[model samples]
Target: MRTTPTAHPNTELLVYGIREIVDVANKIKGLDPALELTWENIGDPVAKGWSVPQFLKEILTEEIHRADNRSFAYTHSRGNIETRKWAVTYAKQFCPSSTLDYEDILFTNGLGSGIAMLYQMVAPGKRILQPSPTYPTHASFESFCSGNAPIFYKLDPEKGWAPDIADIEAQLQNHPDIVGITVINPNNPTGTIYSQETLEAITRLAEKYNVMIISDEIYFRMVFPGHTHVHMAELAHARVPLIVLRGLSKDIPWPGGRCGWLEFHNTDLDPAFKDYCEAVKKRVLLEVCASTLPQMVIPTVYNHPQFNAWNQQYSTELQTVADSIADTLNQIPELTVNKTLGAFYLMPRFKQGSLNNRQTLPITNPQVKAYIEQAVATPNLADDKRFTYYILANTGIVCVPASDFFSPYPGFRLTTLSRNPEERKKTYERFAEATKAYLGSG
Candidate 1:
């Protein structure tokens, strides 16, 4: 039994990287049953007590009752015909001059898959650019598929996490290997919506470099007051090759649907790009198709009269929640909260030099304390991780560290989705208490 371990013969080249977001989420999920998990890690709305609107739910119910919808069947690998047409029409309603055809649209399990397929066609060593403090799935997928980590430009924290246009231009000028740019509007973790000027400037840069624009607009309908979600297709550039990814996951609050689509804007611009899309469609066709039930319901739910009203009321309420949480966190001098323009996340930055290795939240249980100590010993420990581990051990609160969000800062991302008013207040109060304790000890 003392023999040396044998090495595996082979593995997929793409399996080298890890998705820290989901890995950490699984660890939090496996916590002791006695603990109350606050679940501020994942961006799932239904998990936070936001229900699907009655009108949308009715469509699902009707679909279930219909005999024709029962079988699990294959669709066009490109997606259902009706859904693709509806999505095109949906885009045109916003971008009247936008040039996209049904052939350009491709459906996958979700945007996660769509991204992988898109990156697959890109030649190795050619990088896709994104911003720092990014969603791990985007950056990680690019790395996995292309065998290169993403080429990223800086998003200035002092400037409210906006992408530095000059840095972007400089990067593209210096690095001619970059073939595409990724933009996440109403970004995850930070919730900083890209300004219209920023969007246009990015488009111009993409055009200047002759690279495509990969815009992730999944939060398209989750906009709050004073901020609007602008689709890249709607930009005045009707000929800039762009791949816009979107779905019903966020707005409809139906993440389990396993349905999302990619709209290829300006596919005609590059013949090679057109061929790349065709290759992806061929790969998709091999899978029979994406989930059909969701595809079938897309036109129905989107065209319903109630969708707009529900989104307006829902976003208005979400704005209040985002504001309250930001204001509360800002009151704590130890934490700096950002303006959450659209999504339900607020990232509180821990003041520099405020945390130390020895700082901890008050913990009573010996077992939990031991676990926290082990988790905190890892390399590149940030102040946010210190605060997060302490809070988890002491208050039974589970949150994703900003380190997981790919930021150098030491702070955690807190959600504004605690639906119960009194319970929500208690959660914030406990967080503030834990933060104060950690900072005080330091």
Candidate 2:
């Protein structure tokens, strides 16, 4: 009984690449206070100089001082019933083809919590087929639950990061244990929006395989001028179950809020799916409820007269930044840059064989250089990660390696959330220079 306790094998599968790279940058900063770190690793808009809208802040302020004190109370396990009812009405525009009910909306601390719980609830030996270059949270949790590496269907960068239908179908055919397929529209890392045709094709495949569809639509409202976000619920067949995950964290630009919810679509089509939804609810019951104040302000925030204008303005600004960054990165012949259509990220990939372990960026600080050299020297270190550390030490720009997203390609993901135009211009130039130098060294 007193024998040494060991961590679960599943625990080793969990990795949040964004935060990990930040840790590396922090250590480098410690070694060199003059490093002047530019944080491009994480997707926190507020940290990147985005201000919360005054109207939304005023709504939260009003909710906080309500005489009823409802904001402080624990809501129903599923979430605030009235807020869920309002959500049902609001979500209908995106999922016009699917039937939705108030009872179907289940709120969580954030989508991160819900994503982890969803995978954890899966029966052993079953897997959710995730997209390659996935948001790390989904990949890590799904991998942990399966007790192995996650199964991935490629998102073809050559095709604007659209899901490869043939690859997906092949994976489903090869692995009968895949219980569902997850889609991130206006996808992370690669910010391309899925076309309606691509989504419909995936839906048809899911229908053919009888696998549920999990759509992460956190950035659905953040689409740029030319792109459209097609909700999976709209394309999924009636007999195929769907779970649409939405949250206030991204579009609302409120990472501190930590509020998100899941909408169960087509649950009525299958008793097992209904039971799975119930299991998710039961798990939430153990936690009482998500934050009550954020849930309370959902309707007020959405109904505000200035909300749509604010979101549109933000999207336009994001498109501008994406274009600027992509333009800079594209100039480097060693990289492939895709202009982001939605979301606040740009993933510039290295050309095949462009990055090798021998490549490096010159670091002036002796301490920082040694730290980065040792980090990169770790056995079996991915080339993208090695490049990430070198860039961090050389230019103080922190980006998560695309390989950390389980991408087949070697590259890195950086956020386009910086609000300062001059600062962004300088950062992009420095990043491009560093990338060129790194690749040339090889």
lDDT of 1 by residue, 16-60 (tens): 112343444345445644667676666777888888889987998
Candidate 1 segments exceeding 4 Å error: 1-33
Best by TM-score: 2
How accurate locally, in lDDT, is each candidate? 0.77, 0.89
Clashing pairs for model 2 are: none
Q: Which regions of candidate 2 are displaced past 4 Å?
A: none
What is candidate 2's lDDT per residue for 1-442, written digit by digit as tens? 5979888978989998999887888899999999899999888999999988999879988888889999888888889999999998898776665579999899999999889778878878889999999999999999988899999999999998889999999999999999899999979978889999998898888888888899999999999997778878777748589999999897888999999999989888888788888888778777778989899998889889999999999999989988988898899998998889999988889888898889887889999888888888899999999999898899989899999999999999989887899999999899888888888886
- lDDT, model 1: 0.77
Cα-based TM-score, every candidate: 0.92, 0.98
What's the residue-level lDDT of 17 in candidate 1? 15
How much RMSD separates candidate 1 from the native structure? 3.3
